[model samples]
Target: MSKEGRNANGIETLAAETLQRVMEHPATQNDIATVETQLGRYPRGMVAVGARCVGDGTPLVVITGPVLPGGIPFPTTMYLTSPEAVKAVSHLEADGLMRQYNEMLADDTNLRAQYERAHAAYLAFRHGLAERLNESEEHIEGISAGGMPVRVKCLHALVAQSLVMGPGVNPIGDMALERMRNEFDPTVCRCVRAQSDGQETR
Candidate 1:
């Protein structure tokens, strides 16, 4: 779709377009270096670096290609690569927050509707990505990350999507981030040096 046409589809479409343009661009040497240093290895099928640190503008999350090796369709579009963020999310997950979020989704109708919309938007974006990349969308069609549109599963995936797509895109992600404010605050710079080596995360 043309950029102008996508703009007319509303915020979700605009976010998809922004992500599409990022996906089309090749990963720069600097991007590769920082991500590799942060991850301790080379990242595969990395389409674009999405959200960055508010303090330093360093890349935190990334949008990955729909398909990877062995003809596998990757369901998680946005990946949280930041160790600090990952740690924070892990803590939340360990706290059994997914069960609580799932209960919330079951109890509230409006929240469920919003989550369903998020699922649709996520699928639309991924399908567009598949078309742009010349990959088959059959396996991942209608599939979105974090058990969206039904239940809460992975806060990390949801949070990554929320961070990349901006606020109001993923309700569960927004809620999870809100709950874990003390553990992780994107506004502050948490990019510390890796304990194994002296290299900075970003």
Candidate 2:
């Protein structure tokens, strides 16, 4: 498990499991349609680089964890030590979430429920899907807005697959840590790994 008590892969697992829940739950289509319609209305650039959606009707579910944005090196990067290094990487995702959330909050202002529900769904799926993946408890994002609550729904990863988007660490050895920064790319298949039992939905 990564620092902040979460599994490294918890995020993706959450999305997948949540999609499954959505399918089983009565709100599947409506929720998905709303998200899709918004996505379609959204400029292609926005959705491709920054949007993330989950839930499809077929017997398949795909958890899509968005590496939406944010990646600033701590001012003292070179001299950074162990726990510090860990914390730096650990909180990276949380930092990204807020970057997006703050922007969303400005417009929605009162949409805390939406964010919380999304987070709760994310957490639930993380736990449930862990059992499915046979992976040690993994943390999706080490931190989320530090604290927030929303509707909670768990996904069933054992019943779904996962798709992630992010960057690649090439042998540009010099670009080592630099390569870890977020690079939003819709067409780019960030991570295409599949579930053993679940179909290769991604």
> Once superposed on the true structure, which residue ranges of model 2 sit more than 4 Å away at CA?
1-110, 133-183, 188-202
Each candidate structure's TM-score, on Cα atoms with residue i matched to residue i, is: 0.84, 0.26
lDDT of 1 by residue, 141-184 (tens): 77888898798888998998888777787899998888888878
- Model 2 has a clash total of 11
Worst 10 residues of 2 by lDDT: 73-82
* Collision count for each candidate, in order: 0, 11
Using lDDT as the measure, the top candidate is 1
lDDT of each prediction vs. the true structure? 0.78, 0.30
Residue-by-residue lDDT tens digits, candidate 2, 82-158: 12122323354444533444455455634653444434443554444335434343234433222334211111110
Runs in model 1 deviating more than 4 A are 1-8, 20-26, 194-202
